[model samples]
Target: MTTETEAISDDALADVAYLSRSRNRITILEALRSGPHPSGRLEERTQASRSTLERILTELEERGWAERSPDGYVTTPVGERVIGEFRPVVTAMGSIRTLGEAVAWLPDEELSIGLHHFDDATVRRTTPNSPMAEATYLLELMREASVFRTLTYIAPPLSLLQSMRDSVVEGRMTATNVLTDDLVGYLRERPEQTPYWREYVEAGARIYCYRGHIPCNVFVVDETVLIANNDPDSGHPCEFIETTDETVRSWGRELIETYRRNSERLTPETFTEESRMSAEHTS
Candidate 1:
């Protein structure tokens, strides 16, 4: 059989474990640790009912940390000792003295942010303000590349249309368009506006029309980093990113791969039927 002292120690440890599970219980215990009060006073102070306070006090009494009296309750010798030990542990856990020191411990590489811009034949501006110009320059580079691949998320906007026309007219590069359903509809009805789209369909340019919001707009060329922006500035007016950074380039490539894996392809035959129906509707 366990001795009275050993049994009391086991019960004390169990009480601590039980109280630790509830922050409310911990708060009540911490409040009562200073001293004890009447059931009504403790209830008011802790915002618990009298019955709940009595139950908790009963538990504390069973653990030999508190005693009931004619007046109400009081901390026992064991209770004072337990609270004294707990104070230092709680103090150590709560201290935020080294918050700055903890922040300083992070690696230097992860804390760096900068920009590098490249033009067709040379390095352009390498400042923070160069993203817009850099995006336009990168688009021009894709227009000039011999074997360019494009996977646009939305319809070809006017700027993109002009770029495609220039690319075809200059015999620079051919492009594959992976468009959203809305963009496909826009293209189908504006047949006269996008002769390049018709020409591309005729000349074996792969087109895909899908339904859903294409969460991002991305453009990549010849596996070299070009433009990657998640939140481009107002002058840029597009929530897209353009970058030559290795990290950004990998993200762009993964996006393209994911789109290819998920999207359905629309062939010339599909385009012709859709275009004719759109033309008849408009006419």
Candidate 2:
């Protein structure tokens, strides 16, 4: 890739710009990738006027992107490679658009978002009637999984925690949480959750407290990964992007465990001391 990047010539940029100026030209070139097609077939596919089609084909042949074969117009090796690489950029645009505001909160510096990983993902957002839509969807995934882990800077929905606890109590699931110092403080202040936390621990759930690097909330349930963000206005779980893509899931697991390995394991008995250390670290 380094060699290829260095080898890219000024003429290649000009070729790209030239093809980009006319959508019809790109359409015709992409169509020829499969096999040879007559000029009339290209016209029907591109829906361009005869004059426009003829001019575009002439330009393509001149630029070495397409050629007139005995069968018809066919894509050359140069055209094939150009479109093969260019197609991903086009796909990335659609993925970016589909992600919408979720893109803003993603930890892009650490997690390189790639094409196709989230293309077929299930994206959930807080709706007017269901503001906890994102969190609820996570609970749904938890209900079906045998193991789940999370790395978060803020507390998860209490209901989701309760569901995790109950499932773990039945000896049907394993749960682990890698929390930031901020979240430890969040939980420390929630007195109502103290006893529940103890019960959650007794039920075989694991908790570890780490200081930082938890930019966005991550939930990995069995083979699925959910990346979530809060609604800026409501401060509630807003968007949840979930996928079972192996690359993303592998990355997610690595991220969670990497934090956990660096964290201090917490038990019910040590919660207060952990909170105190977290407070001092923050102060």
Candidate 3:
């Protein structure tokens, strides 16, 4: 059975190819993105002549890519869904490829594997019983090691949060988080856990306050190992590797470095906003 993530990926690919086809197609789609539009308006917006635009619209309609109404044209349900799926894929592809190319430009021979998931065991040991099982085992190992050092990353799942918290409580680990504003807000509502919250804050864990979408969740431990999902937009499986691996480690390090550099570019004002918000609730 195709997992939800895989199905979404396929749909997203279809959407990307359709949208990336021609300027006119994109223009028309954008014009009608919000709602139905008259053919005349679409042509004007897309800068296509009436006759030419009509032909294109007719073709799209025939293919069920869009629908016509008295107002103008509207993306069909399928078309809308495709557009929704494709937009993120396009954005993520551009971001990831650009970062990858930049890494390649460096003298390092790093190989970034954009796979759905990584088996932790592959890095810890050579043997494996099942790929899935091995991956789980590897994650546990990483968690155990994470206790002694400071681990940092963007928004991770609740399970990860609990595991990190456990390590910190046991004096095995401390962590910093650069969470989106939304996530910060999410953790703020619960005041009962104020003590735990204080521990994170006092330990120097800070939220990343910004109002934008992050394509994927990244995990880098001690700048030595990096793990990230293949498609940033989709919550597919994730891959992990040691930073020491000539090829794999280099790519992972490059991505972390890129994120760090770009993250620094974030205005201090935004970071402060996040810190303030987190402090208010947790303190």
Candidate 4:
């Protein structure tokens, strides 16, 4: 006898493809969802030609997905179930099409987390009319959040950093900024900003640096997880995807931990010394 898993996989793949390939067919099924509709109505609702509608209806009938009676055609129970199951697939595909590289450019581990976690995410893409949309939104979140964390190669805006620093210094917020060692070294060369960074550490901000290539920027503020991407060539914001889903939040928390665990914790005194040395070396 054929194994159950082997038996279902072949049939299931065919069935899923059957329903997903043709928008006309899906439209016909959806149009018939509310009770029944005559052929003329189906053609109008599905925007399918008379011949095409007839052909799809025949296929649907053969598949037990629909039946015709005096009241035109009505969806079978199985058809209803199939459509319900298939709608999420459509939605997820739509999301993928819309997000494009914003999702694809994420690290390999992020893709392994699967696409379902992103189903509920909100994407803020940069537009010609609003080039700083993503950055502006992230800055707003930073100012409002009671907890802030990031794993990024990109340094945040100084104004936003100052806000977070003040909150942490005042004991009103908890914050961490995890960066690659290369980024930290570069920051040390900026004499004006170096002292401010050291002050950030002294004021209870958690800063960690490690050797690695950071591919994307992740910021978890309060209960939200925000992932951002920028164009590699122009350094312009590409998109920012934000979500408050518990699963994504859990993944974000674990991701921060992984980056931090591999990093060297920088104290205020050590950071100050490192900056001084870096400045000397640069001069």
| Worst 10 contiguous positions by lDDT, candidate 2 | 229-238
Candidate 4, run of 10 with poorest lDDT:
230-239
Per-residue lDDT tens digits for candidate 3, residues 181-227, read: 55555555444433355554444444343344444344545434544
Model 2 CA deviation exceeding 4 Å by range: 1-14, 17-81, 230-234, 272-283
Looking at candidate 1, the ten consecutive residues that score lowest on lDDT are 113-122
The lDDT of each candidate is 0.56, 0.79, 0.51, 0.79
Give me the overall lDDT of model 2. 0.79
Question: TM-score per candidate, in order?
Answer: 0.42, 0.71, 0.35, 0.68
Top TM-score: which candidate number?
2
- Candidate 2 lDDT, tens digit per residue, 197-225? 66778888898999766677888889888
Model 2 residue 271 CA deviation (Å) reads 3.6
Please rank every candidate by TM-score, starting with the best: 2, 4, 1, 3
Cα error of candidate 1 at position 272, Å: 4.9
Q: What's model 4's lDDT at 127? A: 80
